[model samples]
Target: MALVEQLNRDMKQAMKNKEKDRLAVIRMVKASMQNESIKLGNKNLSEDEELTVLSKELKQRKDSLQEFKEAGRDDLVDKLETEIDIIESYMPRQLTDEELEQVVKATIREVNASSKQDMGKVMSTIMPKVKGKADGARINKLVQKHLS
Candidate 1:
């Protein structure tokens, strides 16, 4: 099923099961996607657009999670961890380090990137291929390591 449809089904299931936390997370994702759709002046988002919203939401939660951890807010940290887990459940399986490295290597070769100087070129070419499959920072670090 499409991501949105899946979210809808899961949302209903959460409601029926009286899973407040899970329902809240599903609603949050649905709302984010809806808002993105409106922002683009469209009624529906394409799968890629849906993935973008999911990735963006996941990234925001993760960034917030880091800050919450640094602040030693154990109370908020646990809640955010649960939220992160819920959000991640809707995302595509993350790339394994070896798989990500292989993609980076192939892209480097494809782009003829001899050094970190071609970072932008390599990154632009590779990101679409690995979108939502790998973290940008992880890819950037891997590219830098391979190049240097």
Candidate 2:
């Protein structure tokens, strides 16, 4: 099933199970997806666009969790963690460290990137291949490691 379709079904199940936190996260995801669609002139979002939205949502929650932790707000941190978990459930499985390194090395070779100066060339070539499967920060680190 498509992600949106699965989200709709999960929303209904959340309501049925009286899962307030889970329901709230699902509603937030649906709203974000809708907003993205509207931004694209009311067209349905492509899978890539949908994955981008999901990743953005997850990133926001992670950032919030850090802030909440620093402020000593365990309640909010817990909620944010839960939301992160829910959002991540919809994302593609992330690459392992070794797998990411292998990909970065392959991309560098493919782009003929030999030094740190070629970082941009390597990143541009690799990002599309790993989109929705690897974190941009992690990819950047791997690229830098291989280039330097």
Candidate 3:
């Protein structure tokens, strides 16, 4: 089934089970996905597009977790972690570090990125390959390390 259809079914199940937190997170994801469809001026989003939405949601929660920790708000940090868990449930399994390294190396070669100045070239080529599986910032760091 398509992601939207799966999400619709899950939402109904959540409502039936009275899973408040899970239902709220799923509803937020649905809203985000709808907003993206509106922006794209399209009636349907591909699986890749849906993954992008889930990835963005997970990233936001991670950032919030960091900020909450920095502020010493353990309660908020825990909440953000829970949110991250819920959001990540919709994403594909993440790439292992070794797998990510291999992908970055292959991308560097494909792009013919030979110098640090070619970082941008390498990143743009690698991102889509790693999207939803690896964090963008981690990809950038790995690219920089390899290129340097």
Candidate 4:
């Protein structure tokens, strides 16, 4: 099913289950999608666009989670963690370490990436292939390790 449809179904389920937090997250995701669509001349977002939005939302939550952890704000940390989990649920299945490593290695060769100086070349070439399948930091570390 499409992202919007899935969100709609989950929203209804959350409402019926009286899951306020989950429902709120779902509504927020849906709103973000709608806003993006509106930004693009009111056209529906493509699958890639949906993934981009979901990834952005997940990244924001994760960044906040990290900051809240440093600040010793347990309450906000818990909330951000929950939101991250919810956002992640909408993302594509992530690549395992082995799988991601393989892709990174292959792309490194594909781009003729040699030293750390070529990190940008490898990253730009690999990111589109991995997209939502892998976290960029993980890929960067893997690429660095292999290049070393």
- Give per-model TM-scores: 0.97, 0.95, 0.94, 0.95
Q: Given candidate 3, what's the lDDT at residue 141? A: 89
Stretch of 10 with least lDDT, candidate 4: 36-45
**Which tens-of-lDDT digit does each residue in 1-148 have in candidate 3?**
2888988998999999999888999999999999999999997888899998888888888888888899999998877787788888788889999999999999889989899999999988888887799899899889999999
The predicted structure with the larger TM-score, 2 or 3, is 2
Tens-digit lDDT string for candidate 4 (1-148):
2999999999999999999999999999888888988888757899988998898889888888899999999999999888888888889999999999899999988989999999999999999999999998999899999888
List the RMSD of every prediction in angstroms: 1.0, 1.2, 1.3, 1.2
Descending-TM-score candidate ranking: 1, 2, 4, 3
Q: Extract clashing residue pairs from model 1.
A: none
Residue 65, model 3: lDDT of 87
Q: Evaluate model 3: give its TM-score.
A: 0.94
Task: Give lDDT per model, in order.
Answer: 0.92, 0.91, 0.88, 0.91
Query: How good is model 4 by TM-score?
Result: 0.95
Q: List the residue pairs that clash in candidate 4.
A: none
lDDT tens digits by residue: candidate 1, 42-109: 98798889889989999998999999999999999998899989988888899999999999999999
Q: Model 2: per-residue lDDT, tens digit, 77-102?
A: 88888889899999999999999999
Model 1 scores a TM of 0.97
**Candidate 1 local Cα displacement, residue 138, angstroms:** 0.5
